[model samples]
Target: MKLLVLMSLVYLLGSTEALKVLVLFPYAVKSLSILGTGAVRHLLNAGHEVTYITVYPLKDPPTKNFRQIDISKNAELFKNDDSLTIGYVLEHQVQRTDPLQIQLVTQESARLTFENENVKKLIEDPNEHFDVVIVDLVETETFAGLAVLYDCPMIWLYSMGAHWQPLRLIDRATNPAYDPDYLSPAKNPLSFLERVDELWTRIKWQYRKTFIIQPEERKIYEDTFGPLLEKRGRTLPDYEEVIFNASLIFGNEHDAVRDRPSTPQNFKFIGGLHVEEPVKPLPKEFQDLIDNSKHGVIYFSMGSFLQSNSLPKPLVAELLRMFGGLKQTVIWKFETDLPDVPKNVHIVHWAPQQSILAHPNVRTFITHGGLLSSIEAVHFGMPIIGVPVFFDQFTNIKKAVENGYALTVPLSHNLPKDLKAAIDVMLKDDTYRKKAKELSSIYHDRLTKPGVKFTHWVEHVVRTRGARHLRSPAWRVPLYQRLYLDLIALVLASVYLFFYIVSRLFKKTPKKTDKKKRN
Candidate 1:
């Protein structure tokens, strides 16, 4: 009888502590989905019941607590989309600062996610319930409706560094005077013109988001989630309210590698959480190649999204010619084979990037400036030469340059020469390596591993029932009040009224004097 009571008590406690978490990362970008995967894995390992909605599902067999809703079909949209390729972007001179194009693209992706048969089935299931909903912090605002439907706390996962878009959702907007927009090419300590440009860029984005993007997203939100709400006899809340009601935001950022902004309590930085520890060993061939390098090795990759084969033929030839002349071994992540390859250069269709970076013989990394790559380079104490393609890549590289561990070479006719020059500097300069190591030390100096911290906060939010106390008061404050625009208008109006009164008094005094002279 005593044994039966003890066993029952243990089972009840375990059941009470295990939360049902729904993680939605329906974005087709593999790089972005990796962050979501890291968070989900941690949740699963923590004994939580997780139902992950992903474009890339885990290859391993599922456990009892883990359920995957694969939406890999959505990734087909990007597989053949040349416009998203770096070559197309460079050739067409796409203005990444303009949010219209990307906003539309992400909205389309959200629509696809909502329409996914698996996602729909999950939504329609009457018995489905979640204690918390974790979602990607891109333009997937419509997915926030799930939290509303399930009546669970929503946690946003940001795959990039802290930016105004996600920040404004949980806290106040960042100052544009010094903090450049994520998509803007401008760097900090901006010149007068740069400041004006930054301010205008933000204003334009906000205007477009308010007048254009929001309405479209609202419609999509309603169209997708309306029936579910109707079935429950509940009307949908305002789109903005639903999206902004997130309990917390976990940003892939660290002060050691990137600038730390004034973030609220609800905002947490868990950069490098995706970097698996005890990195897998390199293949024997790669290991031997790195170990036998005379001078050192330069590892070059354009990340998962951009393909090296997409580069213009002339540029590819130029890169090859540059690599041939270099004394250091060059390992390039190229998608397709090239003719007349250099003996010193090695090409791999796919690479174990972290393993390669962890090798001591790797002197420098030539990269696409993706946040993950940048953070990984910092993690392994490798200096970088960034060739930023678009979007936040530019910002990530700019921050690295400002931090003294990296240099940027723009994509153009002079890229080969400029890249060679930067490579030469990175190889010869001990200062860059020293700075990288220093940043690495700081990055590793955290009290807890990022994954542990991430899981703890997530469980904390669940335990505390959304941890509402950590939410910023700024979310409750009106936009006009937050900006103090009303106060400024009141002061300006008072000054204008005072000046008008004085002008009238002077005119009346002059009229009286003229009348007295006539008398």
Candidate 2:
């Protein structure tokens, strides 16, 4: 099998010598924990020594081969609130994303985490060295300090899709008209109004980012790392310098999922790294339930970040009642128990999602439209009914609906009825499953899986100092040259002068002609 061969390659190639690698990702989200591990696991398995910094590492045992520095305090960014529910997520992450509080939280979280004692101890050590550094590329660029301090090449591992900001770090951003903002509700082939909205909003967003955000972020970088850099006789390299030098930007997106033209050479998609070919098996008890399903099985979950228990009690009860009445056996991942559940309905605090989806009897997935969930659904050749809540969920569900393999119900509508109706449509129509299989074939058609691509690429960046050829020339171009603003201004001025001179000549000659005619 290709996976076996890939593992052999890693073993043979990795055993030659050990590489020292440092990976930095301090975000508290559980999904990010998985992503960071995906990037470094190959290196760890291949006999390399790794120093990892993260918020919540899924693996706890420390080995001489691997050292982990926990910065779990970043979890404070998501405050505990009794009122936090799906509706709350819909309001902020979906309706609009530019809340000032969110901005402040991310900026401050990055500053605090990067300045933590554990982080400082590692960076300040005179003996500590690494061949390469990898940092999570989020809204904050200050974490690039690890690369600067170590005097090594950096690979930015972006956990989600490529957005305008990160894309701009590599090359000129894709045209907003065609690509749109990552959060935009509109797809490509926009109406006139949509085009105007995208262009105008993009222009304003850029202006604000350039004038306001970059300066503030730069200040934070200097304020936090100034002392550390000063010791090495170096000031903080500007944000542009930090990101533009990346060997490659690992995007958690699939080529088949995107409709755009060729992207920058440095932008590589390695999505589905989390999916397993032979998915992990479910527990015996859960397996029996799936095997005994008379009709079929519908799997439902809201992912790690959102809790199904957070929904209003009445709504939750109603959904439960409806599912109990249905012929299909229902598997709902709920954090708490219900008093009187139907015999056909099973509830659990945690469910093995991939194994469930892989089972032949499992029919469809109900999800919050998170990128990772959507990707897994497509990978398993299973259709989905998306309950879109927030952030990129809007975009993910829209694509699913457009692809004809899924339907969506917004949280703003009647949650129980909408969800029920969407499920019925998926179960009744064989077309959804057929289309899903088509998409799955496209997703699996790649020469190698995402995991292999990641292992090879990570090693490649380590062996070569950034593989600089991968970087685009646009990275080095000055603003005026790239836009040709000065050249356009000069041409406009020349045209104006020519017209003025011609008009003056005509006026003077016309007066003479009029006088001659009068005589």
lDDT of each candidate versus the true structure: 0.87, 0.79
lDDT of 2 at 435: 92
Cα RMSDs of all predictions? 4.4, 4.7
Report the error of model 2 at residue 229, Å. 2.2
Model 1 vs. true fold: TM: 0.90
Q: Give the TM-score of candidate 2.
A: 0.90
lDDT of 1 by residue, 334-428 (tens): 99988989999998999999999999999999999999999999999999999988878988888888888999998776789999999888888
Q: State every prediction's TM-score relative to the real structure.
A: 0.90, 0.90
